[model samples]
Target: MKNSIFFTALLATTISLASCHNSNAKPVISNEIASIEKTSVDGNTKIQVALLLDTSNSMDGLIEQAKSRLWNIVNTLTTLKYNGKTPDIEISLYEYGNDGLSAEANYIRQVTPLTTDLDLISEKLFTLRTNGGSEYCGAVIQDATKQLSWGKDNDNMKLIYVCGNEAFNQGGINYKEAISDALKNDIYVNTIFCGNQQDGINSYWKDGADYGKGKYFNIDSNRAIHYIVTPYDVQITTCNERINNTYINYGSHGYEKKQKQAEQDRNAGSVSSANYAERTVSKSKAAYKNDSWDLVDKMKDDEKAIDKLKKEELPEELKNKSKEEIKVFVAKKSKEREAIQKEISELAKKRQDYIDTEAKKTKTQDDLGNAISTSIVSLAKVKGYSVEK
Candidate 1:
């Protein structure tokens, strides 16, 4: 009986071991598994851009170029897909120069609000005409600070490109305040200085741009005009075609033809007599000297209207509504009223801010220009280069 019991225990242990081995064995199926999974990062990100343009009389051609090249810019941006997707972009435009004394009409208009529709932006650009007093860096910065809807999303990149021929820092608010505000909001401000001479103003603009975490481009007005008329790609392609056909066509002389054509294309549609005449007429028609003062008066009137609205009695219909209905109605009405009030307030503030920030400043145009140039030179030195004065 003992031997039989021992044999039974050994048999049970063997079966248990076999069961564990079978469970641990790998599967041997002939089936195939396919995965259709695609990896992608979550959330839609966007680039917010504010175009601060100099609308002074001198920037007429620049404005025209910007308007014409806007579509090309948009197309280029579209080609630069981020994370295998096109990024959403919002563009806003502000022109300086309508205000007199660098203060009153500094910011002429917010032509296009921050928006994703590129067509709308294009339309706004077409409508923009240069007719302003001067460029006020501080006023533009302050206006942007108060008006622009920035810092709404962490992933969104905010950029401001201020293009002008005038010196920066001639306005009321100093460079420090503008730079600080821009950095605080993570907004990069690029200064594109379009001028004939290299002066100290360029350096100041570059310094402000650096402080705002942005880039600077010094564009010669003459060269810029040529670029606007002749697209870069056209020039490259034409040159290449000429080089390839040099042996077969005009031999060595064919090269001269190509060079001539390129030069002609580059010099095409420059500021001619007719162009200047048209621009002069446009300027005369769009002069804001009289209209600006009228706008100031209108702003005052709007303020008084807002004050009256605040003090006026509530409408009977709204006053006698049920508690829930009143709550909903009041909410809607409040939002609408707030929007109007905010718009008016911004308009008023924009005017006053320009005046206060630019008009009252003691800095001369040349002084500001020199300061900017020095700043750029210092930056260049730090970056291991010698900047000639």
Candidate 2:
């Protein structure tokens, strides 16, 4: 499901895999199109988040926090009630550092395009490694604005969060110009400086946030992340395993995607059982839809999905079955997945309650998760979004 150069593992999906390319090159495409199709069909607008993380040597801690807390952040988005319904979420990732990037381009890589596949996002976060390299705030921001489709309409809350620990005004590209580009497209460029607030201000990080009309946060990247293990964790993990059983693989990438799903599940478990449980809870949510690959998700997205796919394009398992049979099979799986998801959702609420109570006893510390959570809720409220009870 994920990292290098921690170690190398090949992946087919390009949602957020790591690689460096110039902004002038063709832009990478991911799940945005499918999301657009879904939106057009359902009239469900999306909240887009472009997360630009610096992967230079000293910022390893930030990557770790991202890996652990991404599912929690996904769950956070699910709570948003905008104009009487929750908006769809699409997240993109960019990693900038001289370690595995173009030095001439200021060490910037558009790691992933905007995607709704949360598993892919988790996969890419775990793959990141820190190396000794330069961080250019301006160049990376410009790359995102030029390469990403920020959408034409301003109805969606389009945002960019760039986290780094270096001077904001580094390299040839002027940060003022970069922030100006973001503002032009109505993209909020929030800066998360991985150090002291004063140091961030001194480096002009706050100025960048001001230019884009976004929140500015400074985090202690070295702080260890803490999770409260609740009695509901084991139940949630079991529910997660059961949920996986309901996925009906019926396309070329179906089997691979199914395996990758389990692999990411293991990846989360390897980090912490609590992280795994949190991810399981996320998988149960509405945002975990992966219609691009899985038949159940595809059918859910469009009722005519079976008719749309040619018989040759169907997976080997589905080839022998009648169209009617395949439809019935997918429908059964969808129902099963729904039941398991409901159970996980119920358990997750209890888990959150337990954690929320335990949270009162701990001291607050600056970290990637907290910074994003604080900023996302704050900005969403200002934009007419509500957190549903």
Best by lDDT: 2
Global lDDT for candidate 2?
A: 0.79
Error of 2 at 291 (Å): 0.4
Please report, in order, the local distance difference test score of every candidate based on alpha carbons.
0.44, 0.79
TM-score of 2: 0.89
How many clashes in candidate 1?
14
Residues 23-91, model 2: lDDT tens digits = 455443455333423322234667889999988877778988898788888888888877787677888
The TM-score values for the models, in the order shown, are 0.46, 0.89
Best TM-score among the predictions, by candidate number: 2
Residues 177-241, model 1: lDDT tens digits: 87687778877666777764355254477777777777666654433322211122232222323
Worst 10 residues of 2 by lDDT: 1-10
